[model samples]
Target: MLTPMLASLLPLLLLCRISFCQYSSDQCSWKGSGLTHEGHTRDVEQVYLRCSQGSLEWLYPTGAIIVNLRPNTISPVAARLSVCIKPSTDSSGTNIYLDRNGKLRLLLREQDQAQGKVHCFSIQEGALFIEAIPHMDIRRRITAFQYELVSDRLRVEAESLSAPCQPCSNTDMLLAVCTSDFVARGSIKKVDQEEDHSSVTVELSRLYRQKIQVFVSGGVRVRSWTGHINMPLQCGVRSGEGEFLFTGTVRFGEAWMGCAPRYKDFLRLYHEAQLQGNNPCQVDTD
Candidate 1:
């Protein structure tokens, strides 16, 4: 009872629907020889592994599981190094390592799935050797933690070995500004000459708000500019020449210099303060 044109169109529509469903599933498979850790030769066989739905369900849209076939040879100095399954969509994936003690540590991008199967490769004397792990269930072995959107990319914390997980908090510029007494742009002049003291002079380029002062017991008072602030010294801002963004107690004269920010970060914080209808320089009473 159907027209010829209508019948032909129906078949095409069904095919299109099937293709759409496949794409939406986000299913992935591995397409290369397995990882090689001990030799320079590549395995000739191509292995295909399906992504586990149980693992992919837990990750952010950008999260993925990594199966480190050999964790010991990941170091730069190691003669035989292997890397497989690098995510193509995101070049900013964090490098995680399994230490000898079985503790998984993040190698880059502290703090924070394309469910895909990646082929592992071993490098020897400048030649790439494929390493293979047969019938590996990667999803069950790796654990992901703290998957959150960080800027344009999803920041994820994950471990390769099956073990207990520790949580990490997400701290951004706005959170830092809201928690501190004041935020400003400044530069470190020099480390003070006092013995056994961790003090530095900061030349304030711009103060977001006026400085504050506080008094303690015994009628003693401290200034915020005296470097009583507890900023991490290892932030590499100690060279004392380049400009930086600082946040700390203005009254106590202690300031911690964080890294420099883009112009948009300062603008974003400025607008955030406007939304709250409160002064950004207001001191914390608690």
Candidate 2:
């Protein structure tokens, strides 16, 4: 009892479903490329890596996410170098990335910034390879970072250090590198936070600092806290910790402190509010 026209559109509709499925799983593996485990200098190399999902399921519905070391077999088992997949293709035509423990990791879309679009995709095509940048300092070093299209290619880069010279004992070396890549679009996101005189803080923190996707949905409301005149901000609840995490400084009533109009735009804040609404925004730590 199926009409020819309806049947013809089935495949297209199915593909669309696969393309928009919002998925996440907690799982990771070692995806680095170095032999030395000496955490002395900027030459430090990661034996393992962690990743989240970042693409829509299209033709295959499922794709393989590989996380191998830069020079496979150079580091030790404790270094932990591997990759994992949730096999979304098997279930929904999309292969979701997972951690070693089989947990879900979230991949984020890059926002507009000084570094440009760190994580954004147009056509959703091809495999991506990322590079590594040495850390500026050991204390404030970048443990891991996602990559984006520099000009022509997608890249992921890790920041670590090598062993320092004899003169510097505890100082880190600027040699080792951390890098990870998966199939699909390449990108990154930065952690942005806002604070006020009353100690009101809005922090956007993620498991992986580089992979935060920005999504916008209809009916999302945003506002600012500091009440600036320019790009005011909007306030919202974080999903996990239930904290006040403002997006861009938009306008709250009148001040341009921060604002996020849509739920998806403020997904992180919504997530936090859902889980920790009971906790006062002034005292919560997470």
Candidate 3:
């Protein structure tokens, strides 16, 4: 009762329909369940996420899912981008892996998800392959994480573990001003020591440039700006320290200290460079 052509087309059409129902397109965040066909299908679905940052949640684990994350706009750093994922403290039910051409490398195991640690890999490494860990009861299991795409320059030794703590040379200071996310003349007002890093409160006398308004303007009365930046505890940054020419990177909406030097030292270096016409960029030192 059926022609050969119709029978072959039937399977293809059904596959397309199933795929459409499985994933959302062009989404920055994704939320879905692992329940599948016949309630035991162990099917693998493809998820496409286009954004620099987002979150994913999967409930009722059963099968697997491949998450494809790529930038929406092409940029020079696109090729150098890395993916960072912070697993939720309670996330479970799946083992995460990297999938390239079907070859898989484990990224996270099920038991480790509860640790809520952040993991990173290059974008070129592959899509995220999250496979459900087999369990009899699928009722209470879920996997969730927040992800961010960042350039290599922006993705340094996070939490100040390997963050550069040495004083920037005269040349590096000049260059940092030209390329850093924020530059200002400031002083440490308070330093809160943490296990691995120190949180520094800064009062900026002059803000040269900033990627965003991370520093709150003190207005006419206060006549300056104030903000916070994190530094490696080993840096020994302390409150009441003398003024500094501050520079650093802002990651995930938080500022991280970079090549900060004594304001007096920077003034001397800057003046010498200006006299020599070797300064990378002009700054109003007044």
Candidate 4:
């Protein structure tokens, strides 16, 4: 009872439906690092092991476990992630010490049915950035701290958008991007000079709303200067056997401020001690 025209249209409609589904799935997979699809209904097996998700296997110095997966359908997707752990918590707290190189590995395998697609996605990938960590070694009552310097500093940024099609008049658009930089440095120290003449310097520069805060006491003193043009600021602390000096220079847009009250008190104490010929160096944990 069916007409030839209707029969022909049925196949075309089915094909269009399949194409739509395929396109939707492909778009979703773009947000993921790895995606595998099985044209059939059989299960698929695969292995994944690495430090962080979305990480390339060859780049990992430490190996991970071989994973055997039974994807519910035919193909399955998986991603390896790489993460860096720091031995020290904060720049002021951690001793920069490096051990023969440290590394870690992890493995993940799917236990359920493996006939479908395996999707390897990472929510944290777009936010990944490099950070500094302090390395330290302690023996008996003595301690030494060292800073591990990272040569490469990378930052990630992302944005989202939504819009509707229109012929005229009505229009709307919204966009935002987040950015951050890794602070890489080779050395950081604080001490007083008496028998050895040493000096320290610290500097920082940012937008008008940004400000740098420094804390000093006893044998420590600080000095600062501002520049006319926008530039990165710098601060440093130097120590010797008899005295210690802290200086900071801020460079930014034409308008800037260089006065920090609490830091001035520290410098005052250091200089006052020098005028009195007294060693202002005192070791105290705060």
**What TM-score do all the candidates reach, one by one?**
0.25, 0.19, 0.78, 0.14
> Between the candidate structures 2 and 4, which one is better when assessed by TM-score?
2
- By the TM-score metric, which is better: model 3 or model 4? 3
lDDT (Cα atoms) of all candidates against the true structure: 0.32, 0.24, 0.78, 0.21
Higher-ranked by TM-score: 1 or 2: 1
State the lDDT of candidate 1 residue by residue for 31-60, as single tens digits.
211132122121122112223111111121
Candidate 3, 9-91: lDDT as tens digits: 33443464356645665479998876654444345677889888889998886556778889997877798899888788899
lDDT head-to-head 2 vs 4, winner: 2
RMSD of 3: 7.1
Ranking by TM-score: 3, 1, 2, 4
Q: In model 3, which regions exceed 4 Å deviation?
A: 1-21, 35-41, 59-62, 74-77, 111-118, 135-142, 157-164, 219-221
Residue pairs that clash (backbone atoms under 3 angstroms), model 3: none
Give the number of colliding residue pairs in candidate 2. 90
Which one wins on TM-score?
Answer: 3
1 or 3, greater by TM-score: 3
> What is residue 63's positional error in candidate 4, in angstroms?
22
How many clashes (backbone N, Cα, C below 3 Å) per candidate?
Answer: 18, 90, 0, 66
**What does candidate 2 score in Cα RMSD to the true structure?**
23.5
